[model samples]
Target: MYQLYYSPRNASAAVHWLLHDLNVPYELIRVDRKQQQQKSAEYLKLNPSGRIPTLLIDDQPLSETAAILITLCERHPEQAKMPALVSPDRSKFWQWMMYLTNTLQNELMVYFYPHTTDSNGIEAIKQAQVVRLAEILTLIDRELSHHTYLVGDTLTACDFFLFLLGYWCLALPQPLTEYPNLTRFMRLMAKHPSITAVNDIEQFDLDCDIFTFID
Candidate 1:
């Protein structure tokens, strides 16, 4: 069995969705952000960075959502079947995942938590991140026009990763539904039973209208 430490509506959500998608028995250990439980000594012992979505596989612990998802996919090949070990799409899968995590998510965090990056120029940094976010969204929007999923037709952990990012994009002044291709892809993703289960567990009120806005 796997053990997952999650905080509602955090970066850990992607991992949570993946855990459900895998359909393997896993225990969710909630780290209450309100009480600073993630930073607690016990939690820090699991993750030195004191981050979230730490999965305990066997007796060992795994951190970083991207790495964890890749590991899980490799472990449970019967589930996703997309991130194949030996294929051209395998490389492309890594490409899109890294772009979402390292590029888009990196900028989004800076924007969402500006004080961590620039204490004095918070507003300037945040506004700059907004522009960067839009540009990244456009690239993803275009990619979706070519393929249904990030790498290929079948669903992969990358979809869950992108779903969490796109879901959070709701906080932006511009609605994600504006990106027709991306919204179309998102609508397809929103119907997945694994995602439905995760939202019910986390009580995430993801706006279903985002689905309704498109076809």
Candidate 2:
């Protein structure tokens, strides 16, 4: 059985959702961020970066959400969560996955944790990120307007990654539902059994109409 060290609603949720989608046996070990448990020596040993998720497979630990996600998808190729090596969609998959993790997720981190930057310019940095993030969302929404999924019709781990990012946007001053194409994509993904399971376990109300504005 795989062992996953995670914190609810963290980047780990994407991996958790994939595990459920793959229907694989896995154990969840919560690293309580509230108590700084991720920085504990024991947890750090498994993940030197002291991140929320460190998946243990075959007695080896793996960190980094994107790497972990690709590993899982490759390991369970029968599920086809990652396209085949020679598949035409393969390149597109890599593109969006990197864009989601490197571009979008990083900006979101800055938006949420502005203190990570220069103390005197935290507000300015965060406001700049807001404008940049809006542009990123527009690109994603435009892409979704062309295809049912990020890469194409077939759902991949990239979609799950997108879902995670969209979920994070719930805390933004402007709701994610404002983007119609993104909202449709999110609504479809929100109904998936894997996503539903993860949401229930994490206690996130992402599968409902919570995004609808209260006029």
Which candidate leads in lDDT?
Answer: 2
Off by over 4 Å in 2: 116-120, 207-215
Clashing pairs in 1: none
Q: Which stretches of candidate 1 lie over 4 Å from their true place?
A: 116-120
Which digits, one per residue and each the tens of the lDDT, describe model 2 over residues 156-199?
Answer: 99999998899888777787877888988888887789887667
- The true-versus-predicted C-alpha distance at residue 19 of model 2, in Å, is 0.4
Q: How close is candidate 2 to the true structure, as a TM-score?
A: 0.94
Residue 214 CA displacement from its true place in model 1, Å: 5.3
Supply the global lDDT for candidate 2.
0.89
Q: At residue 118, what lDDT does model 2 achieve? A: 61
Tell me model 1's lDDT, rounded to 2 decimals. 0.84
lDDT string, candidate 1, 57-97, tens digits = 99698998888888888899888545667677988899988
Report, for every candidate in turn, its global Cα lDDT versus the true structure.
0.84, 0.89
